[model samples]
Target: MSSAPAFRKFHLMRQRWSQLLFAHWPIDPALLRPYLPARLELDLFEGQAWLGVVPFTMSHIRPLGLPAVPGLNRLHELNVRTYARLDGVPGVWFLSLDATQPLGVWAARTLFHLPYLHARISLTQTGDTLRATAERTHRGAAPATFVASWTPGDVLPPAQPGSLQHFLTERYILYTAGANLQQAVRGTALWRGRLFHAPWALRQAMLTEWDSTLVESHGLPTPTGPPLLYAADALDVWVQELRRI
Candidate 1:
């Protein structure tokens, strides 16, 4: 895996993430190019591209000087994403980020310059299993839904560099091109946000149930093969303010 940027002395946001499920499907690079800005190249491995559907929950979300409000602090999130590079700086490029909180959605979109949408989502834990259900409910946005139940298995060591797992899950920066994904096709403002977090304490996750329409919502075909799945329990994170790229 790669290292993060120099740690920021101050961060605009602090949040804790839990029950993260990372599901990736390999796809043709050409299929994703049109969704990103022409200036950004698809970050590929072994001449292949990947699409990821990640489901997780966020807690204690707060801006630098503020207290976390009770009604707006906790939410479930699901994102459709891919990897990309701008001048060789690799980072995540999201197609859509669906969250259960409307105010959080608006705040993210307005302040971060990222695509964030409202959705109906729930994530529950029973014993060692996690069950999640999500449906995009944003008005006029592309419809999507996800259902999954998985149990974390044996813990794995940190991913080594050049490995598929490393390439897919070890990202620390994110690139955003526009307020929405559709606006990026023709070119728009491009920004980068740096995140600082320790290496994921990853584990193999056994899927007992899985179904999703996130990729198809973007006009991509359903992945023909089963997704590669990995899980992480919790991590504290810091997000720097977005900077023009």
Candidate 2:
């Protein structure tokens, strides 16, 4: 894959993502196929698919040229995602995103057509360790909770094109659908949002603690063994408006 794509035209939102943890596990392609829309294909590495559960803190969220709103500017977010490709462009396909701010959830669902849910979440730092927790509170939605603690380690070199680290962390586009696969096949619109950020400052991470059912809540099996872990300091991002594919 080429380096992270750039989108300098215009952006609708700006935010800082900090103290992030990327935890991923391999899964069978057949199991994840049914969850994706017809217009997008499951992106795989060496014929194997993977699922990721990311927990991070969002700060300085605001519309372009506007100041950050007091209560909406900061929040904790956790997301369950998988890799996808549409017309040869790789992007993230989110199954569910749970955030602490209800307004943020509503805006994401309505404006971006992403599957966003309201949740109770918190993040704390103790010395060199970071702790995160999230519980999905959306009424009638599948119950999910995540609790994890990690310590950042030495910084690593940048991920190369063919590496798994690059595949999982370097994605710059996100694909979402307003309808299910059946509707997509019937000509429903699929949306793709582009994001621009500096190359990830990756670091080795030690997952000191983890107990999560976020993936299983979506009807998939709980991940087995330890996950592939990585951490990053922070990055300022610019998100362009969602476009129809």
Candidate 3:
């Protein structure tokens, strides 16, 4: 498999992600195939598919060369996502993205054509443990909520290719679909967004506390058993503009 690709072209935005909790669960491929766009394929690792629910804080977010706005500079976000590939390019395909800030949600939806929803979200840190909560409040959308706490453990060596950790966290591109249009010739054209970031400084994570219905809210079966967990301290990211693929 290919490692993360570099973006030599101009990036449209920049942001910092911190205190991230990567929680994932294995799922049957059949459960997700029905929801994915016709042009995208569900990515798998060793014949198993996975779903992820990640919660974190984003800061210093602004378009390239622009000063970060006061209220929009930072916020909490939670996303329900899975892996996918389009024409041989691996990327993240989000089922839903919930953010505490409205403007951020609007920009993600309008500018990137992703499923961005407004939610009530909060994060607190105490010593080595972090607690996060998110409740989707977007009108006319299915309700989704997540509450969990995690503590970082020993730092792990970088994930080798083909490992589950690498499959779950090494993604750098994102694919999004625009609103469905019955008259459109290509019903499910996909858009690709590229991101540049340093390799993740990952550590084993202990799930100190948890409760969530975020996955089931998407009409998929509730994930059973504990989720695979990993934590990252922080990373600076540059995002490129979305383009048709």
Candidate 4:
């Protein structure tokens, strides 16, 4: 019998969900280097996957005239010194949405990686949910769309690194479900500004354990083709455990 896939503990580093849709564009590698952390690391596979992380840090403060409430600054922000990585394949790019800004445009043109990026993000409003969608063009010809909706939780628990769904959900909720998977993920300008979404308000609740090397997925085929399919049906299904890793 085969062993089940173990999910790693998740880090509740972010909360708000911001989705992006990219249509046709090219990215430059050199342009990305400057934005990455000095001590960053990367592992690349031809036109397929690239995994790496750069250091990151961000602060929040209202502009001179903006309101100074506890959480009200999603207009202008800044992301500093953050590290991120990705494992992108044909349709798998649909699963990664980690950063606030759409940094994938530069990667596609330069690395020929995750040629297209797309997705949507849901926010919390008076305990209800508010969603926003964004993206950029990559493939130079193809069009793609990514979407997700989430409810707001007052307390986003730290994901157990070994909990694939938990960790991944936290990751997507915090990082990769909106942009180019192959692109380097970074802190967004929103962090330095406001906390318009639940994801942004939960950044300080991170607790990391040992780095995990386990990856698992619950993927489904698409009606359009193999390149376009739904990963799962439940948008609100709380991750239980991976049937396989």
Best by TM-score: 1
Residue runs of model 2 more than 4 Å from their true location after superposition = 1-9, 179-187
Question: Number of the top candidate by lDDT?
Answer: 1
The per-candidate count of clashes, in order, stands at 1, 0, 0, 57
Cα lDDT tens digits, model 1, 58-99, are 998988878899989989999999999988899999999999
The TM-scores, one per candidate, come to: 0.95, 0.93, 0.93, 0.27
Superposed model 1: Cα runs more than 4 Å off: 1-9
lDDT of 2 by residue, 1-245 (tens): 13323553467888889999999999999999888877789999999999999999999898867889999899899989999998899999888888999888888878788788889999999999999988889987789988999999999899999999999999999988852323433455789999888889999999989999899988999899899999997988889778987
Question: Candidate 4 residues 1-245, lDDT tens each?
Answer: 02212321321112221321111111233433443323232212232222221111122322323443453323211111112343331111222222233433343223332222322222222333323232323243233333323333343344454432232222321222213322333432111111122121121111111121111111211212111101111111112211110
Model 2 C-alpha lDDT versus the unseen true structure: 0.87
Candidate 3 overall lDDT versus native: 0.85
How would you order the candidates by lDDT, starting with the best?
1, 2, 3, 4
Backbone clashes in model 1, listed as residue pairs: 1-161
Candidate 3, position 180, lDDT? 25
- Candidate 3 Cα RMSD after full superposition onto the native fold (Å): 3.7
